[model samples]
Structure formats: C-alpha cells, structure tokens
Target chain A: MSIRNKYEEELTTVFNKLIAMCRTVEIAIEKSVNSLVHRDTELAGEVIKEDKNVDNLEHEIEQDCLKILLMEHPVASDFRDVSAALKMITDLERIADQAADISEITFQFGEESFIKEPFHIKEMAKLATGMVKDSVQSYINRDLELARSLDRRDDGVDNLFGKIKGELVELIKKDGRNADQAILFMMIAKYIERIADHAVNIGEWVEYAITGYHKIG
Target chain B: MKDKKQTVKDNLDIFDFTSDIAVNIKSLNLYYGNFQALKEVSMELKKNEITAMIGPSGCGKSTLLKTLNRMNDLVDGCRIEGSITIGEKDIYAKDIDLSALRKNVGMVFQKPNPFPMSVYDNVAFAPRTFGIRKKAELDEIVETSLKRASIWDELKDRLNKSALGLSGGQQQRLCIARSLAAQPKILLMDEPTSALDPISTGKIEELMSELVKDLTIVIVTHNMQQATRIADRTAFFYLGELVEFADTQTLFTCPADKRTENYITGRFG
Candidate 1:
C-alpha cells in the first residue's frame, strides 16, 4: 500500500475505536443514571468499571492521532479531521468521567432507597446522551449544521438544570429530614449538566474539523 | 485610504521595469462571492524566467497565479475585472478561447493529483486530449516530458504501473511532466514541494532550474530556501497587496520592504 493509504487505514482504525469508546460511554451513562434513580448498585458498579475501559481507549486514540501529526504532516481537510478527533476525545473522556461520578454517588447510597423522583436528573441524562450521540455523528459525517446546533440544545439543558436547583431548594425547605439526600441529588444533577456541556465542546470540535473554526452556532 | 500609506507607495513607485514582459497586469481586481482578494494589482512577469510569488497565507499570490491561466474561471461566483494580457493579448477578451488559453498556460497544485491513472497514461493523457495520436508520438512525448521533469530514469521501467504506486515526490514530478506534455508557454506551480520530503523537494528544485531554459515559470512558495534556489525574480505580497518585486538575490539579501525582510528572516509571516 502507498504511504497515504497506510496513514488513511490507521486513521480509520483509530477513528472507529474513538467512536466505539463514545458509544460505550453513552450506554454506561444511560444505565448508570437509571441505576441512580432506580436504586440499582450493581449497574452503577458496571458503569464505573466501563469508564476505566473508556479511559484506555481515549489514551490509545490520542497517541495514534499524535503519531499522525508528528509523522505525516497532513493538511487541508485531513488535517482538520485529525485535530478535531483529538479535541473530541478530550470531551468524550470528560463525559465518561461524569458517568463515573454518577456511579460513585450511586455506590455511596447503596443501602438507602432512591426516595426522590429524580425526574429532572433523568431528563438531564437523556439530553446529555443525545448531545454525545449527535456530536459524534456530526464528526463522522462532517455535518456542520448539526454540530453547531448542539449549542442551542445546551441552553435548554442549562435552563432545566437551573429549574432542578430551585426545586431541590424547595424540597429542602419543605422537610428537614430529606435535606442531605436532596443536596446529594443536586450534585448528581450538576454532573449530568456538565456532561452535556462537554458534549457541546465535542460539537464545537466537529465544526472545527469541517470548517477550521471553533465557534458553535 | 490614508495619506501615510500613499507616501509609502510613492517610494515603491521609484522601482521600475523597462523591458519585454510575458504577462502585464493593468489594474486587475478579483472577487469571490462578495469579498475582494486582488485589489487593482499590477505587475509584470519577465519572459522565460522563474518568478517566485512569496507571501503569508491568503495574500492573493495564488489568486494572482490562477488569474494568469484563467483558472479563476473554474470557481463559481469568481469575477475578474480589468485587463490581464498574456503575450500582449487580453486574456479576458470576449473572443479569447479559454481552452486555448489554458493550452498556453499550465498549473501544478500544492498537492500532487496524478489523476488516478498509470504512470505512462498520466503524461500522455493531456497531449492525447489535445489531439496528439499514434503510438510513436505518445511514447516520444512521455519520454521527453519525464526526462524534462527529471523522473524518466526512475519511472522509465514502471511506465505501465499506476501513478498511485509511486512515491510522493515521484508522483508530484509526474504531475509536472503531465503539465509539460501539453507544451505550455508558461507553467504556474502553487507550492509544489510543500507536500514532499526534503530530498524530493531538492530533486524538484533541480528539475525547475533545468526547465527554466525553455519556459516562463511563475511559482508560489512559502519556503524562502526553495525560492533562492530556483527563482530568478521574486514578488512579495501581504494582505492582498503586492509589496515589492525584485531580483531573487536582491530580494532575499536586501529587500526594500520591511515586511518582505521580516518574512524572509524568520521574524514574521
């Protein structure tokens, strides 16, 4: 094979591995959030362990991309894609960390049943998962419009998070006994909100890959 | 727009050329979409010589080169205003045929695009397209073109093989040969060696020096070292403006413009 073909093959393998890592983390976040709301410690443990695997994948892809940058000295669209992949991995790794944080919280309250509805927390997870999936899809397809659209959706997540904080304050004021649990629940909501924000960062990187610009929307 | 800028240009006007010119641009302006790239740019290309266009990225050096061959016409919404005369005929004249103009002017891109064909086919395709026929004629043209590009010895045995099989430098040289096979009067190379290794770039620089004997060549390059090696004259551009034009030795050694000196001495782009 030609040198270009060899580099392209390596690029594809690394990119596919990155996308797989994102997908695995997305699933982990989904199940871990469910475990928190539904009081399933076992599923939370699985999500924590899966995040370790995601970390390894992130490191592997990071090295592959750095190797290409140092060796081939690519330009134009190919250069853009390689750099975007690096930035995307950074955000993806952060998303996995948020998922792991949820798992840790779930493990902490293993004995106590999840009393609160956590409806707002569940919505936050769903939005975050959507962001991760769309961000990676935009990167894969070089879809500038969809990638930029993540910013608008991010505003929605932020708004919902603010409302959740207000509701938790009301819950704490209503009953003194549930105050500690309400604060823990608020921390979980904060982590999920951050996951969504990191997803937006990935979206920004995808746009950068396609257009060589960093701004979203 | 400012009086101080006008005063600086008055000094630039002192530099003059009084001789035969292969290309004479009189107030050329180029536009893509709504943004103007070249603004009333005027310069002369001396005949049968290597003139290097040097500038930071997006300074309209490539735009000026493209206009010489009318490659700007390939871009949608790109409008060229004012006269660009090649060999004393208006290139923008309504009666001028684009294909014939392109036959006289050829281009090599920054990256080597060898048309996904066999090594022999890449050199022969253009001549054949322009109405050259017969096995003896094609073979002769390919041999001469490759020899001129300085890749004949390396590629002579693999003439039937795919161009994709060649090294990056060899493929790029083949691209130059393909352009030469058309027998163009002027060759426009846009950073040809910016894609190759140092060794490959050295070979190309040597080939360019040899080909200067017969053809008028205009090259755009970021490498200051490559320009000194092959170019006879150099033009410096900054922000879509032609800053200065002079002999290669003089430009590199004693540039009239501060910007040109800064760019060459590794202080700035």
Candidate 2:
C-alpha cells in the first residue's frame, strides 16, 4: 500500500475523471464529424446535447484538483499533475465546444447535396479525432515522446484544412451557386482544424505533467 | 495598465539577488555514542534568508539544527566532526567560546519555554545575564526585542505579568523576543510552530518572514507547507543524509532528485 493512501486515491479519481472527460470529448468530435458526413441531424443533436456531460465532468475534475490542493497541499510531481489536469481540462472543454459548434452548423445544411465530396475535410476529421485520442493516451500513460509528437501530427490536419479551403474556393469559382454550401463546408473544416489545435494544447499540458517543461509561454 | 505592469516589475525587483553566506557547514558528521545522527551534511545558509530543513522524524534534521549552536554538546557521549564556520571562526575550535557562540546563534525549541518570570524580565534575562544592569538599558532592550518579535503592543500593558500567564502563542512570541534580546546573528528554530494553532502558526510564520530581513534563520519543520510558504531555500534530509538542497520554489514544484520528489509528494515510505 502507498504511504498516503487517501491522497493517492483522490489523485487517481481526478485522473480517471480527466480521462473520462477526454473520452467524451473524442466521441463528440467523432459524432459531430459523422453527422456532417452522413447529414444525420439526430447524431448532431446528440453531440450538442451530450456536451453538458463533458462540462459537468470538467467541473467535477476541477473541484477534485482543488480539493487535493486545499487538503493535501500536494507538491513536486503531484503538484504538477494537478496543475496540468486543470490546464488540460480547459482545452478539452474547448474541444467539446468546437465539436458542438460544428454540430450547430450541421443544422444549416438540411438535406442539401454537397457542392463537393468533402474528401479532405473527412481526412482532417479523422486526423483531428486521432490526435485527441493520442493526447488522452499520452496523458494516461504519461508518455512524453507521444505528447511531443502531437505538435508535428497537427501539421497534417492544418495541411488538410488548407487543401479543403483551396478546393472549396476553386469549386465556387466554377459555380457561383455553390458559394453557400462551400462556405458551410469551409466553416466545418475550420472547426476540425481548431479541434486538432486544442488536442495539441492538451498534448503540451501532458508534456508539462510528465516533464515540467511547457512548450508555450 | 502601463503603470500597473511597471509597479509589478518594480515589486519583483525587490528580491535580493546577492547571497551572503552566514553559516557554512562543511562535511559535518554527528554521532551519539556509537550511533550516527548526521552523515556528512554540508550546506551554506544565506544571510538574511530563511532556510528550512524538512524530513521525517528521526532523519537528523533536529540534530543538524542543534549543531548550529552546539546545543548537542549538552548530550551525553555526543561527538561531532567537520567544520561549522560562522564568518571566519570555526565554532568547534578548542579556544571557541560556547557562550558567545550561543549568543550569536540563538535557538527556539519545539515547546515555548518562557522562564517563569515576568514578561519584561523574560525578554531582559539574556541581556541582564550578559551584564546590562542599568534599568534604562534593560528597558530599551526589552522593548526593542518585543517589537522585533511583533508582540510589543499586546504585552506592553502587561509587561510585569508572569510569562506563564500568556497564551501559548504569546508565550512562543515571548520566547522569540527573549532570543532576540541576545542580538543573535543567526536564529535556529526546531519545529517552532508544530505545537501551536493555525492562527498562531500563521503569526509566527509572518514574524519569521519579517525577521529574515535583518537576521538569518534556519528552521527545522515537519510541516512541508510551512517550508513551502515561508522558506527561501529548503534542505531535505533522510536517514541522517542530506538528500537535496534547493530554492523553495524549485524544490516544491519540481525537485531534481527522485527521493526529494517522493518525500515532498508524500510517496516516501
């Protein structure tokens, strides 16, 4: 048994809650993108509705971190763990919000045919959701190497976003009537790119939790 | 907004960057008869800064604190090696004066032990023993010491009252005032606030912060939070060995040594 059994238990509970919150966020990104690809209003609505769960989980994890700080006054790696959890949750919550934002955009394209195939946008969603999953995995395993790799992986998502934007612009140039749907697709791609950025932020925080070196100021 | 940023920058500049060594302990080893208490401990405490020693019980933190003033010399069969120098003088030298050494390095114990005399007399006892017989001189020393300990306003009206009549917190402050009366260059405290309530502990912590501007302080504490809150630097001791010494912020946030990290994070067995 550990020396500080109760403190260890409380910290474990907070970590588990953070992992659960990350899972919910990853699912939101997946379902929101799926709703856009399949035009399923029900799944998009479900993504929007379930965001409340992610917010509540974020709140609970935040309170747990505060309780550990107030009661145990954790230091060293435990202090870093709590601090990183607090920071990572903000990015996770933002990712959930962006997922919901994409879902809200899904309501605008009601049964309309796509101006283009949205191939690069789908690829960007896949990469963004994968980054979120890998960020959470890095946190769960305290893998510094995996966390550091996320920044490079985000380049793939950004490139895909650029490709999708260029494709939409060229499609609108060919047919001016495609502007409205092309603009909505552009918005969706931008949201996916933002989701990947939030995932990268989570990865930076994970790196901080493991090694105490934050890449950003 | 520009003024606010400049004000913050000015406030941050108040930290003293020049470190003057007050006590330099070099390869110090202590033993009680055949049993070793401290093992080759070496550290330099900065002048006018609070350095806290933290470890589990029986880790020789208190033994090291006692060595600063040669208080361990009173123990039976206690032996020490290595040099502890305050400025240019080696404290363990054969011709060293124990009285002057003690006067230079005053100590406060875990329990507040105010001699059962009047509060005024308690503060004046050290000076009076050192031959300050004049009433005016004794009165001035007593008042300045009390004010330095931050307890003058409360005890000024009751100076003639017995030290035993004060509250636990007040008595501890009186004990500190008594130590200050000696005009010590370095003050050593062994678990000074472990016996007091939180409010009293806070007052003492504040007093230590205020006092460090004029005098150096070395405190041995079991309370890690106290070290984090008030110490400029902290030393972690374990099993009679000096494990790690670092600035308080780095030590508590991200200690370089794994043992130091485990100990601070409560993962040590």
Candidate 3:
C-alpha cells in the first residue's frame, strides 16, 4: 500500500507458488488413479515418490504466507488471501497424502485384475480430481461461483463412494477368497472420497479469500 | 449545526459508540480556507484504549488528530464545524481554558522536538508552566513521568544531560515524558515512531500498551502494521473522509468499504 513494488511482487510469487502446488497435487491425483486402473506398479511408485515434493511445497507456501504476514502485515483482501492460502495449503497437503495412499494400495494390487470391475471407484476418483482442479481454479481466479458450486460436486463423490462400499460388501460376501482385494478397493474408494472432502475444504478457503466469509453461501 | 446533529443521529449505528467514550466526534467538518481537509467525520474513541488513524499522506488523519486538542487553531484560515466533546465538554465552547485544555490533552509530534535543555528540565517544563517550581516537586513529577514513558532506567544517570544530545528514539521518549509530566488525561501522537529504528519502535509500541491503562492514546500513523500491532481500534481515512472504523483485527483482515480495502491492500490510485 506504500507503493512498494517489491512487496507486491513477493505477494504475487506466493500466490503463483500456491497455484503451482495445486497443479502438482492434481497431477499426483491423476497419476495415482491411472497406476491403479492400468495396474502399473512403476507409475504407482512414482506417485509415492512425488509426495515428498508436495510436502515440501506445502512447507514452502506456509513459510511464504508467514513471511508476508510478519514482514508486510497485509490488510483487507491481501490479509484474507494470505490467511486463506495458509489454511488451503493444509487441506491440499492432506489431499496429496490421500493420493499417495491410493498409490500405495495400487502397489498392493500388483499386476492383478480387480475381483470386480472398479467402474464406480474410477468414477469417484475422476469426480474427486475434477473437484480438486476446479477448487484450485476458483482460488487462483477468485471465482466465487466456481467455489460455491464445488459442494454439489462433492455430493456426487459421496454418492459414488456409497455405491462403491455396497458393491465391495457384495463382492466380499459372495466369495471368502476375494476379501483382501475387496477391502483394498473399499479403502481406495474412501481415500478418493477424502480427497473430495479436502477439495471442498479448499473451496471454502477460496470463498473466504475472496469474500472474507467461510460459509459456502 | 442542528442538521449535523440530525445526521449523526441518523447514522448512530455506523458511529457505534460504546458506553465509555472519551472523545465523541460528531459529523465534524474542517477546512483550511478554501480547501476542505476533513469531511463529515464522526467516531467515538473509547476510554483508556489506543486508537490508530491510518491513511495515505494528506488524508486528513493528522487533521482530525489535531482537532482533538485544538492544535489546528494555530493555523491561519483553519475552521471547524460540528462538535468534538471530551467527556461532555465541547472543546470549542466559549470560556474554555486553552492552557488547561492543553494540559488535559498532551501531544507528541513526528520529530523528536525536545526543548534545548537538560533531560530533567524537558520533562519538567510543562509542569513548571502550570506553576510548579519547587525542585522536590519537579523532581518527583519528572521521575514518574520518565518512568511511565519507559526511559527512566536508561536515562536515570543522565538526568541532567542535554536532551538534544540523546538518540532520536530517546529524544522522542523524552518528549513523551514531557507530555506525561503534565498528567494529561489523553495523549495524542502524530507518527511518534516514524523516525525511529525497529528496535526503538518496538520499545515505544510496548510502552503504548502500558500507557493505555492510564491514558487514552490516539495515534496517526502511515504504518498499517504499527496500527495493527498497538491499536485496539483502527480508523481509515481517505481524501479527507473517514472510510472505515472497526476493531483493529477486523479492519485489517476484512474492511467493509472497498476504498478501505483498496488503500490497505496497496491497490489505491
């Protein structure tokens, strides 16, 4: 606000870095799901290895937010943006961990076909990834409409998770030998659902950044 | 005047007066000849609280601050309308004692403007003007004032030393001590630490938190961080208008007015 060019530029860098971290998590989500669907243990390993970078990015953005908070003492929308990013980064970091967890399950599948078709789980993962991407988009663009609309998409993930859980139960009941794989499938579905929940958290933070209110409406 | 009172009544919610208001400014408008410097400003400064006024240069924050103690009366062609009452007493009312008014409302300027005298004398100067000449009495007042300003231990051995010889931060504290010596009920500071280094600024800011227990402080500052750090409440002024006034945290995190948001976020033109 003092017409200081460097302060403005540093704030922009923090914002851009947060977006980059979001992009990294989105990529991780896609790769982790792909490794499972295609039964590629190598791709699954890559997703697990990439999680370290995601963790580091979360730390980096957090430090940057704190730097701006302490050095610049941002006010109003600038203050909101910094603090919202602080909270959003935590949610994003959790989402990254969920993606890694999914890849870890994919590694356990180990070149074997699913006991049953994983169509609903795949649909759930796809919907969750879409929510993550759109939430990040809303944050970077300060798109209120996009941020508010994310809650409805979360319901879609929830529905798919419910259906996946029921189908997994049916698979486990029909044959005792398929129990282990069926439980893994259920866990993967839960992780995807958790990712969607984290995306909704990011959406709430985006709304807070733009309007200074956490309530979705 | 009647219409101005009506306007203030109409916007009572916006003014948001608490029960213990020390200074109640009601739709005050100030001008310097043809140029308006403060326009229809109304706000209540709570008792025993530190309130910070912040805005860009020439935003009339200092203008409103000067009005608190009638410091602007010295400027030629300056005129004020409406009311600013300190504890139910209209500051501009006839038969008001200017010297007594100043004694009750002390001030510290941006630059360290200590008198060219010993540190003890600088602190005692104000009390002396009001007819306290005994050495023992002056010593007691000077010591207490310096202690309250948080410069006593540092300057205890240097009491008789020339105040002008001290550091800028010390000189500023010496000025604050001088104001305190008069036992003023309110202290008005205009960029009191703008000339000091960060460590010195921290000291004065710390001192402010302690001082507010006994004296209401109104500070005008260009530093938004300083406002957030020391002030309980913050008021943002823009082009001679009061844009927003709220608790310091709320004002900095989510100011209601777009103009306040723009100015605080550095997007102002």
State residue B54's C-alpha deviation in candidate 3, in Å.
Answer: 1.3
lDDT of each: 0.84, 0.89, 0.89
What DockQ values do the models have?
0.01, 0.58, 0.55
Clashing pairs in 2: none
Span of ten consecutive residues with least summed lDDT in model 1 chain A: A71-80
Docking class of 1: incorrect
TM-score of 3: 0.90
Stronger candidate by DockQ (2 vs 3): 2
| Candidate that would win on TM-score | 2
Candidate 1 chain B: worst-modelled 10 consecutive residues by lDDT: B9-18
Give the lowest summed-lDDT range of ten residues in model 3 chain B: B8-17
Docking class of 2: medium
| DockQ of candidate 1 against the true complex | 0.01
Candidate 2 lDDT tens digits, A110-188: 7778887767877898899989989988988999989989999999999898888888999999999999999999999
Q: How well is each residue in A1-217 modelled by candidate 3, as lDDT tens digits?
A: 4575877788788879887998899999999989888888899999999999999999999998899888877778888888888999898999999999999998787666789877888799889988998998898888999998999999999999989888888888899888999989989999999999998998999898898888753
True contacts kept of each: 0.00, 0.80, 0.74
lDDT of 2: 0.89
Put the candidates in TM-score order, highest first.
Answer: 2, 3, 1
